[model samples]
Target chain A: MGGGKRRRKLNAERSGRIAALPSAAPAEEPQAVTVADAAPDAPKPVPRSPYEGLPARAFWRSGVTEQHPLRVADLYRKKFALSPSHQIATAGSCFAQHIARRLKGAGYSIVDREPAPLGFDAADAQLYGYGLYSARYGNIYTARQLLQLAREAFREFEPAVPVWRKGERFFDALRPSVEPEGLASAEEVTAHRAAHLKHVRGMLKQADVIIFTFGLTETWEHRASGTVYPTAPGTIAGRYDPAVFAFRNLTHSEVLADFLAFRKRVREVNPTVKFLLTVSPVPLTATASGEHVLPATIYSKSVLRGVAGELYHRFDDVDYFPSYEMVAGHPSRGFFYEPNMRAVANAGVDVVMRAFFEAHGIEAAPRAAAEPRPKGDREGGGRRKGGGKRSKDDVVCEEMLLEAFAK
Target chain B: MRLCFIGNSHIVMVKSAWDEFAKSHADLEGEFFAASGSKMNGLELRGRSLVSDNPSVVDQLKATSGGRTSIDVDRYDGFVLVGLNLGLVNVLRVGQDHRTVATVGKAPFGHLCSDGAFDLAVKRQFDAASSRRIAEMIRSVDQKVPIAAVPTPHASRGITGRSNQFWADAELLSARAEQPWREQLEDFIRACGVAFVEQREETLDGRYFTERRFSVGSVRLRGMTERVEEEFRHMNADYGALVLQDVMPHFGSAA
Candidate 1:
């Protein structure tokens, strides 16, 4: 019985060897082809290892550190300096406002391209979800959607209003749910939208630098019109047509394509403008998609990151700033934001700004230690006034009064 | 004299006290830039503007002033900063779709400040080496005018058991638990060189009960008002009384 078993094992091993021989024979063909190709003019293929050996010199010592090298703040500062003379245009998620605020604070010119009226406060306009770049009234969920909005706005057939009229700031139709008593007419709204689109196009023409922040890859779109809305239409204010509304999760390829298209459109109008893109550090407030919250956040961020990488590689004039890295990178773990709504911490913003200044070789101002108050002047001794009770009308109109009267 | 209060709900109680005091005086001029859930960061009032994004109270002040040149600073005679414990603010939401859980911590959206991006950012703001930018703005408006920084109030007495577990859960955090929410409040008050009022100690001494306990006292059994009144008196003597004294000058002048 043992002899019979040994014979059977020998036979199985022989068959296995025969089976492997055919695979090896096929592999040899590539070797033979390489050897044949190596003759004379044909270059010899260099053998490479997956892990390359360390260079003879310490390449890192020259300037690179072991840590992740690029920082968002530094990039922003460098770009800010490089494009000092450029007219800036900003739009994207919440973080996009950061660029606008920074640029405005730094005294760089941001094109007055909002589709609102002159008297409309820019800050208030933003609260109503206007003034941000893109035509879907704020439907800028990703770089691609922003490009699509820009394209559609620029290509409107009837031209609801002239594309480039001066003194137009708000789109009356898209204004927030303020009291309807003083609202503009529908025609005025249409006209404002047209004028706003025109201003955006003109701004595109004038801008030497367009800073766009990539906020999220998830977006809700109108299926029929292919129009994207900022929040789910109902999330903010707008007509929601369930049949027309659809959720979309943008892929990296789609983002890259949209970015490239956006660049093309910008170049078509203002050939000399450069693009600087940054991923927003703000996290998702809530996810509508079915994935786990953490995973969803990761996926959304990863897609944006990939898009940023692809665009940076493809375009020499376009640069990517690692704002996402600065805030959410593994080392930092999201410390720059406050707890509740993930508002970026004041210190976090300062860190980003400081890096920006350092990278650009600009001097940073020093901060004085917060001074402690004298002990003799404690609270109870001080007299209090002006905290008075008011009528209901007074209470109701308080915000309005403050808005109108407060400096 | 115009006094401006920049703060959140902790100032609500102060506002209540001030309102009561004002009823008696009837002649003071003041304005409050206070909202129910606002921060020194100006997160609620500023929307997407720099005021909302700035981490430093000084930065928020600058942004609210609409740049350095626009801040008259002299318009107000006194500045009272209340409730600087940003850690207590609810800034981020966690969990899955439809079952999302909201928590307070640094870096509400992404992990920017949670990871340490804010430290670097703060360093950058301070590194500018010019205290005058912010200090001058404050002084220009009210030279010799006192600036008061009020510390954060303590948590109510009733947040216990599983409810309190949410405070330290990995998925979310309260701003109070993270930074010097309490300490920073004290620091802001101290730094401003005004009368400092520490309200947490009194509030923690069974004065402000949680919603659960407050409900129980109000509904369960009879004769609960005595206990409640006792707690209120304790808080008044410990916390409210101090606040009243701090702003006595303004009160007297108004009267």
Candidate 2:
């Protein structure tokens, strides 16, 4: 008999004797039987290793190489269930807009504390940073940026410089792109930021789930106050001075600590709120770090991924969604990127959302009706055209402006 | 001088007032085209004629214009588009819920909006108005034909405690919110290259409410012969006569 058959016979005999033991009895200690204990008729007992009964997922040959990428079953098991009633607030990098749109489209209750003004169409509304997130804080690229926003929202901290200027227009230093044209005066920027913070407070207080996508580890921050910005100062409006601004490539511990601090701050107002974390799969547009952009992106993403993993393991309420792996990982075979290999194709977003909805058992709702154009004007205005696919201009990313400076 | 008055339901008062004026003044001729609500949205410039395909609107146009199915642009010296969903009252309603840095502390309950954003929204509202579309259509047909656009008249008095509570909130707002928008409307109309006929100041209670005497027995646009007492939106012939007098001079006609 082969070793396999002999092992099957031994397994069956062992189970039969174990089942026959009394329910209250202690487990018997293994006796050191020599060759005398072996049955006379049985072939030498096969030596069975612990890996004998492991599932197919435990082995790379069966787990990955043999399975289709889309059919990678049990890839995600949701740590917590989300119902339609949950008031989900989403904010992160530009990629998180896809998650927000998908969730809102799925009939989940998305909190829009800073909703676009009534009668404003979708395109102009998005340009003004209204519908992109719950409170229009705009692309929060780093954990430190998020923590800073929360602190500012709660009035616990104030940045050294709250406003930045370009020509005659002034911008909020924290979320500079929110007002593309900028405000007329520094006072206007301050007032807008104040009002925005009030709504941010309301959003944090009301949300049951806060879905934040960890986008980058590299950031530009004020040297003195440690106030991190979503983009480098000069990328949008403010002047970039090396004396005042410093480039930071955040380490694993720093990113993890920033998130924990942010989590704690939010919990002060909302004790029971759950966190859903994701890492944006998009690579860096340009890296200020002397390292080549390729390795810089990998380092940034790896650090963010490591932090997510640590948080996922550390807390019961914190859940990590592998959107980064879904899009950037080799399983998709580079099929999910645009020709430039930077922007995520819509197909990739669809795949990630499909997996997300499947795991949560949420059926897709009918797609939203196309936005109506501004009355009497068939053209012009910031409205989207050409079917419903988001064009390249659909997402507003300040980081992409960094490439303009590259030689 | 020959002029054409075009608009939605609110044009009825202007037409009624013009008929009374034309009975005494023989030198001026006024042609009127009226469609109720958004029916006028279908009216477009096809070649040099302003026309529509909707049968009811066509019938109404024929009835109002002495059997003419469409207005020939070359025939009219000027055009006055009245009550085509353009108004400043909407600014007041929006202000009740949102305030700019200029008015933030004053309206404590309202959400704060940047002054620039609020200004853009106000401008966009005017840009999307149906009255602007009509002006554009007429301009495309005949750029030199002087075009004057009139906003919807203020809500009538005694609308305060009734079903029209929204007007009351607007009425309570001060001139701080009202003056800037009125200026914006003028600038917007001038930028469109159309003349703006300001609603008669004496006829208004504040900026948003017409005197009860002028609106007491306003007539419906469809059945122009009888007056409807419950109507607080349409003005009477007396109120219209005053506005028409202000509108005719823009056409270089004094009637």
Candidate 3:
């Protein structure tokens, strides 16, 4: 009789606890929910809106207001907080440089494992793609490029087509613009890439955060070997051969698959690393999809943004920063871009950085007045005195080569 | 002590500074043998003297050494090669990409190592080539003569003006090179069996660039007044005296 009475008491307690909780649990909540027991008849269970009490990003977001102008409010609600010592390693498409520069300026520790030689000036250093990323990998504009780089850096995954030759000069097929003038021989390029991989490995092992800005879905690659390149062949160094190389417009599924594979590989090496993802706000400089460049840019960014968003939901450590929506999205209009309507202006960078800091609870950073143009602007134009034809003051975008084919 | 100076347009400052330096050290006398362009590289060792290879080249050595066609290399107590391409950009070009501030995330440098091994190798190779040429010529004339190499000076910020917008990436390097680039250059020149005159530590701003007050004038440049109005790399007599000061200790010592 006493054992039966105790079972009855337990059932009563469970019902009381369920009755105390608010109508429903969050549909998309990750982790466990807390429950408490109360004395009596509580409110009946009812379905609650998933959007209720959701973060600002779950709703319509706008940073641009009549008063704030270029600035945005509630743009980034960070899932993680970065301290001054966070080892941030940045590498991605041409636009990614702006993010890296701002973080470094704000005094957050950027993981620069491979520093250039002493006495080099800013212009010459960048010409050789020195300060752009963790290991000098030039404008990694595609998901395939990012996945291959991670694989090449850590695993034994070597591209079957290792080197590309233009005239007598040899270039690393993966990242043709990195050497600027190109290497003397295939052996030199391999040796150089080996050393670069070491730095990349170091970056992977140590970085607390790796912000990858996906730039393009359009890619040209080795059809047989399934190798992807930073830029199309011939624009910078290699010759374009249809028989050997094939143009691929990656769909949403392909990008998502690659990112998942990248994340899995990354976990094998760097288990604790948190990933911050952003789709490049800059438009495509050229399109091989036989479509207008405008629609091509849209299609590319959309696929990338979609994959990145899904990845955010799929992985706990992966967070989406929405730099794409902040700059290219309709809320801010197109005020952040330069006259070229492609290059993101400093004010756009200013607001992006502001949101990043605000969301992460990092104090506002002081103005970096000594900066010339946006770091992304260096992706195209100009020349280095001692090096190749690269923008000495601005960014050097390989996509700018498309402008050459115009008219 | 008598000195013979060998240089390009950079020789003008040392020539101009001799008197002011002489006020403190009256024992020094110097002579110049220089011309513009590739002609400066044509200095040849004829017996124990240097002579002009080009007939069109001006031969100031002829006047300095009585009526001889060339000045006796052994006659001079010291030799200085001023204003060759000592510009930091020259060192920067030898595979040292010092820009650290940039966007996005890190990527692999194509056929290039970001570990600095590739860049350091390039720098070493360039230094070797330059050292080989200088060592061969200097040892040919006389191993005993104290020779110094002063590279191109960096452009002054005063002339360039303070900029806020363009140089966020330069923080990758110290105002001066953290690695002893001067010492490395000195070691290279010394391995060449010659002395290297180091730039003064105090005269530099953070970027390893020279100050504007020393930015006097260059004979090589077309439009230079007595006062330097821009961020010119060449130095004047006052600056020349500073270089000479670094040169003094080596000269009095046996070569």
Which candidate number has the best DockQ? Answer: 2
Per prediction, fnat is 0.00, 0.37, 0.17
In order, the interface RMSDs are: 18.8, 1.9, 8.8
Q: Which candidate is the best by TM-score?
A: 2
Score each candidate by Cα lDDT. 0.46, 0.76, 0.66
lDDT of 1 by residue, A1-407 (tens): 69999899779868776445543322311222345556677675553421123331223332234333334321343333544566777766555555555555555576655433212233323322334443224424577557765685578423212111112221232222111121234444454355446656667777888878787877766676555544454322344557867888788888888888888887988887888788866666455578875787788888898888788777777877777777777556666766643455556655765565466454543321321111000000110123222221111111122122223
By TM-score, the candidates rank as 2, 3, 1
Interface DockQ of each model: 0.01, 0.40, 0.09
Candidate 2 lDDT over residue span A1-407, tens digit each: 99999899779868775554445333233223357758898786543434444566665556667777765665677999999999999888755677778888898999988877655667657667787788978778889989988898899999877899999999998888777778889988888888899999899999999999888888888999898887788867899999999999999999999999999999988999999999988888778899998999899989999999999999999998888888889977878877767677667777788878889998854434542211100001122322132333444356446654553
Model 3 in CAPRI terms: which quality?
incorrect
Worst 10 residues of 2 chain A by lDDT: A372-381
Whole-structure CA lDDT of model 2: 0.76
Question: For model 1, what is the error of residue A265's alpha carbon versus the real structure, in angstroms, after optimal superposition?
Answer: 1.1
> What are the per-residue Cα lDDT tens digits for candidate 3 across B126-218?
353332344457668677777777665555555333453222322233233335355556566666666666677776766556776787454
For candidate 3, the C-alpha RMSD (Å) to the true structure equals: 18.1
**Could you tell me the lDDT of residue B163 within candidate 3?**
50
Report residue B184 deviation for candidate 3 (angstroms).
16
Q: Please provide, for model 3 over A1-407, each residue's C-alpha lDDT reduced to its tens digit, 9 standing for 90 to 100.
A: 69999899778867775444444434333222223432356653332554344543343432243325455566667877788888998878755677787788788898887665543455545655677787777778777888898899976588867788989888988877766667777877887777788888888888889889888888888999899886678866778889999899999999998988888888887899999998888887778889988898889888999999999988889999978888888767798888888887777887887878888877767655545332322223323334443333365556556566464
Candidate numbers sorted by DockQ from highest down: 2, 3, 1
TM-score of each: 0.43, 0.76, 0.59
